[model samples]
Target: MRGKKGNKEVLKRILLCIRPYTSLVVLSLGLAVITVGLTLYVPILTGNAVDYIAGKGSVDFGMLGKLIVLIIAAITVTAAAQWLMNHVNNMITYRIVQDLRVQAFHHLHRVPAAYVDSHPAGDLISRIITDVEQFSDGLLMGFTQLFTGVLTIAGTIVFMLTIHPLITLVVVVLSPLSFGIAGFISKNTFQMFKKQSETRGELTSLTDEMLGNLKVVEAFGYQEKAQERFEEINERLAGYSLRATFFSSLTNPATRIMYSIIYAGVTLAGCFTVIAGGLTVGRLTSFLSYTNQYTKPFNEITGVITEFQNSLASAARVFRFLDEEPETEDSPDAEELTEIQGKVELEDVAFSYRPDQRFMEHLNLSAQPGQRIAIVGPTGCGKTTLINLLMRFYDVTDGNIYVDGHEIRDITRKSLRSNFGMVLQETWLKNTTIRENIAYGKPDAADEEIIRAAKEAHAHNFIMKLPQQYDTVLGEDGGSLSQGQKQLLCIARVMLDLPPMLILDEATSSIDTMTEIRIQNAFGKMMNGRTSFIVAHRLSTIREADVILVMKDGKIIEKGTHKELLKQNGFYAELYQSQFAPS
Candidate 1:
């Protein structure tokens, strides 16, 4: 069985989300009550008409006409009320969906990088899109019928009790049988539905990961392995879905079958009462009408219970995502970085991706304004991790990183990051016009400035060759452009912004050798007076750095200018020779 407290929490949150539309909810439920009330009253009027027409052996055509008119009026009122209720229900459903989607989307931005790194993007997307929609649909459809079903049941039972209390007691006792069956089936189905939802998210994540790395999988001849992984996840999803649906499907038929028996018993008992003159024929007929009305809602409610259970499962998933702790907020007295100098220093820095493993400890470094700092290290030696700390993407665990004499964490993240420009090995370009992609860092940049930035990044010649020049709309992630071209656009973005500090991580790795040379010349001009940190796999790229820091296992093993490092003949010299003197 599901946790009662957790379900209540989910329900409470859902209600809060809908609380803004209180007037709509009241109007919708009111219309449903009115519709059900008119329906129940119709049977009472029909019973009275029957008694009047059967009295004293004379047919009263006038009374019959009047009864017919009243019944028609009730029918019209019921229809109008139902239509209005349905309209309101639909409106509330879509509006709540919109609000929930917006809230989830906004929450994602506030979430920390650690949470994002741990969770798959597709799983997050599933919660926001598919799960929210399922929960919303179930809430709207079930609630629309639920109000009418409940009021109809209560009103019909009360009317039947007034007509014949003895038979109404029978309904009260048998009603539990339907509810019991629904409860039992729902308990079994809840976990199955929950599992199915989880598996669906896994499947979505798998598909996204596979498609995003299709080229790598093909190049490494891992297509069969990828397909096998997909099939495994897909099969698990199918199994859970089948079991959940099978159990929930049992509720309606089982409840209806039990209610059929109750209906038969009520009919037989009423006939005997009428024969013994204990109840009028008209009263028995009215009671029978009310009995059908009362018991039919049990089946409706059983179906609604299944819908609600499924919705609750999906809602639990969505709410769990929204409840994640976001990134730590800036300090109350945080200062904004108004004018940054190029000097940066890391004092007694310590960091680790996990608590048990300290990747870097007691690290200290400093860069003078307008210095070219090149960091060379073996893979997994905390090179990028250092940059992450400086930019405040991840905070230093045990020490301080300062920019212009102020600790990095004391500054607002937006302002601190605004002073640094980054071009990583993996280029990120949006699906938009070429000009827009280049001008992303400065959305309001002038056309001439954008072109000049592109020219400086050595991208203008090829961009001009495109069908629409800068106006060409690129496909998703700029798939229409080559890797080198995409990198150029990314570089142009930073060049246009002209941040005081630059971080280049294999910025020219994807370009051909000739293009690399051209772009490096452009980068040399761009880096003239900026504090730059260059991380490159190709040792030749940083040959002219003001200082080269050779790292091994997160510790600095050597640091000096190129000539000084070479004369020392240390780790940096070995790394440089290994690249230049290849077999």
Candidate 2:
């Protein structure tokens, strides 16, 4: 029952995607009907032609010529209709695929960051690309064959009934056996197909992980182990694929056997009717043709059950991704945040990634306009988590964060985030020109403005050295550039637009000491009148900050200037002195 419900849900979403292309589907259906009707009619014309040749020289040449012409005309029309039907099906199928991929990708962004962080990137990519492609193939096959198959079956049954009721009943009586075979097999095969799809996703994920981090894998000399891991999953995937294919393949031959039986029985019955002089030789020939046409649908549909099962599995994966819980919507009364005071405050904040593991609690801080606050903490000390809360990437559970006296959640997230510029230790650059990467935060920035920001971030020297200068294109997140170069570009991006507030989380960690000094000077100018939060591991770099926050175990254990913290001779002093201590 649950499996049936899942299938229904997946089908419902697929139909919903098809809603915009309803016109094309209807047109395709009409063409399919016409194609089948005309195709079925040709058999009758053939039967008539056979009657014309019943006895040598008794043949009616004139009648035979007309029947032959009608047969040729019917065949031509059917072929045209079939072509038109397939064209319409392709249009509908691909259009539906386009819409689904767009929706799933767009929704991916709206989902909480945690969801993406938890899932493997390759699995997600598989759903978007591979799985979606599989779904499209299934849909295309269904449109191309399923409709015509059903129409052929119906048309043959109707035409056959008009000729002889008793013979038709014999054919109809055995159809239930074919359907039962298909239904029973299809029901059991769905689970295998679903497993096969999932295993394929895992294989993709592993391959992606290894290839993406080829450098690391080779460096660690884990190739043999990696290959073993690959083979282990590969073997499991093979088992699933084989099972799915084996079961689905059975449906075709199984139905064919039943069809063969029906065909034989009908032939004998029609031969007997002809012997009794109740049926003409031409009619028997047409009846036999209809028998093939009738069984063809059952064979085709049962055959498609293989693709249909796989498609359903792939479709289920995609729809599940589309249905992921999006990030919570802001309050209805949320308003655009404006004006640039640069003041921020966190009051009684409490949060955690997992409910049982409280990352932070009762955390509080205040930054006055133009004050430079340095956050110093050991690893896993909520330093980045604090930054995340300030930026509203993850909201506080028990407290309110305020920007210029307005609760952060009360303001639009876009407006709130736009007010702050951030540069993190980890750099990100798309496969695009350096100028575009820099101007990402400010796409309309003039060339002169972009170059100026690049100069400030100490990326101008490297940009000028590149073959294309600012127009130099990056590859795979700026892989061609050194870590420091990428970091510089990221810094230049934030420098391009110095918002009212700033976040520098180890922004200088990748650069050399000499360049760090120069870039720090640039950052000082950028942060001069803007409230800034700097989460740093190097204690010396933040000596000039107006206030230094010392964090430990998810709490701010101490807060003061460097000179004051040293005088106290506490955790902050211990950490600060150790960095500069002798080996």
Candidate 3:
């Protein structure tokens, strides 16, 4: 069973989204009332026409014409009212969907980097787009239709009873049975729809994964395997969709059957009353019309109820995302750093991606301002983990990290991160103009400043040679540029930011020897007067470091200048010889 508190809370949140449109809601309800009033006059008009035609009452042509005119006027008014109600409903839905999308996006931005890393991009995209759209279509339209159906049903039933209590009994008797069928079908359909949505999310995740790694899939000849996996998900989704349709489709037919039975019973009973000289033709005609009107709202009500159930299921998923807690940040009183010299120190910092294992423990290091420090280690030796901690991407579990003598946790993350620039091994570039990509780091930078930064990164000459020079558009992920050229553009972006501290994690690892030399030269200039942390697998890149730290198994096994480390002849010496020695 669903918790009562949870249902109430979710409904409260959904209602809050529409609170701003209460005036429109009021107008819609008012229109619905007018529509009901107009439709209720139809049965009375039919009764009057029957009496005049039967000649059992005095005939008045003028009065008959007026009654017919009133019937037509009522229909016209109902149509206009319905149109206005629909427009208001659409406006309210639009406003609510807009607010929901914005709020979901804002929450996503505030979530922790770890949460983002752990969740699939495709799944997140589906929740924001498809799930939210489902909620809008189902919850908004379903509820509006439901409200109108209820009002129509109530008004019709009350007027119906006023005509003849005996006929009203026939209609009311079948209602409970009709509702039971609708409720059962709705419950089954809701389950199937939920399953369908879940399958769709999985299919979306699979497609995104394949597309993101298309090159690898092609190179490894896994296209067939990927397709097979996707087909499995698609097949499951189709099954669930079909099941939902099968169940929901029963609602209208079952209600129609009950409506037919009630109509037949009422017609038979009216004939008996007329033949017994107890009821006139006009009264019987009016009762039949009322019976039809009464059943119509039940049909509509049943359909809306089914739709509401399905929508509620979708809405539950959407609200779950909205309720997610984002990553926490520093308190309002957190310290702010205006300027940083980039003196960094890490003492006994321990961390683990999982609770049962430790990736790093008791790690100790320090770097002076403007000094170039290099970290070298084997694969999975916590080299990148150290950089992550220093950048405060993952807070240390055990010890303190200080930059310029201030505890990292005490400072606002934005203020702390503003002082550092990073260039990763895989350079990422947006599908945009070269000029815009370079200026991305500092959006306010002038064209001349961008070009100057490009020159400083040794990327200006090559950029000028492109088809449109700086204005040339890059393909997705900078596909238009060679690997080395893409790396050059990344360096230029970093140069534009010109942070006080820098982390170069295998920045030159992918470039050719010739490009590597140019990058190294540009890097030396950029490093001047800035504290630098260099993680290099290629030992030659870090020969000029003011200090070198050798790490193994999350511990800093050795630390010293290059000459001092060579004399120690430990892990660093072994790693250097292993790479440079003859094959």
- Top candidate (lDDT): 2
Candidates in order: C-alpha RMSD to true structure: 1.9, 1.4, 2.4
Q: How many residue pairs clash in all the candidates, one count each?
A: 0, 0, 0
The stretch of ten residues in a row with the least summed lDDT in candidate 1 is: 1-10
* Tens digit per residue, CA lDDT, model 1, 1-583: 2487888888899899889999999999899888999999999888878877767778788888899899999999999999989999999989988988898999998898878989998899899998988898788867687889999988988888888889899888888988889999988888888888888889888888888888999999999999998999999999999999899999888988998999999999999998898887778778888888988888888777788887888889998988998888899899999777789998989988799999898788899989999998899888888888888878888989999998988899998999999999999998899999999989999999999999999999999999999999999888768999999999999999899999998899999999899888988998999999998889888989998888888888889988999899888888888888869
Residue pairs with backbone atoms closer than 3 Å in model 1 (clashes) = none
Better of 2 and 3 by TM-score: 2
Sorted by TM-score (best first), the order is 2, 1, 3
278-396: candidate 3 lDDT, tens digit per residue: 66788788888777877887788777766665556666767777777776679778898777888998878899888898888998888899999999999989889888888778888
What is the RMSD of candidate 1? Answer: 1.9
Question: Runs in model 2 with CA error above 4 Å?
Answer: 55-57
What does candidate 1 score on TM? 0.96
TM per model?
A: 0.96, 0.97, 0.93
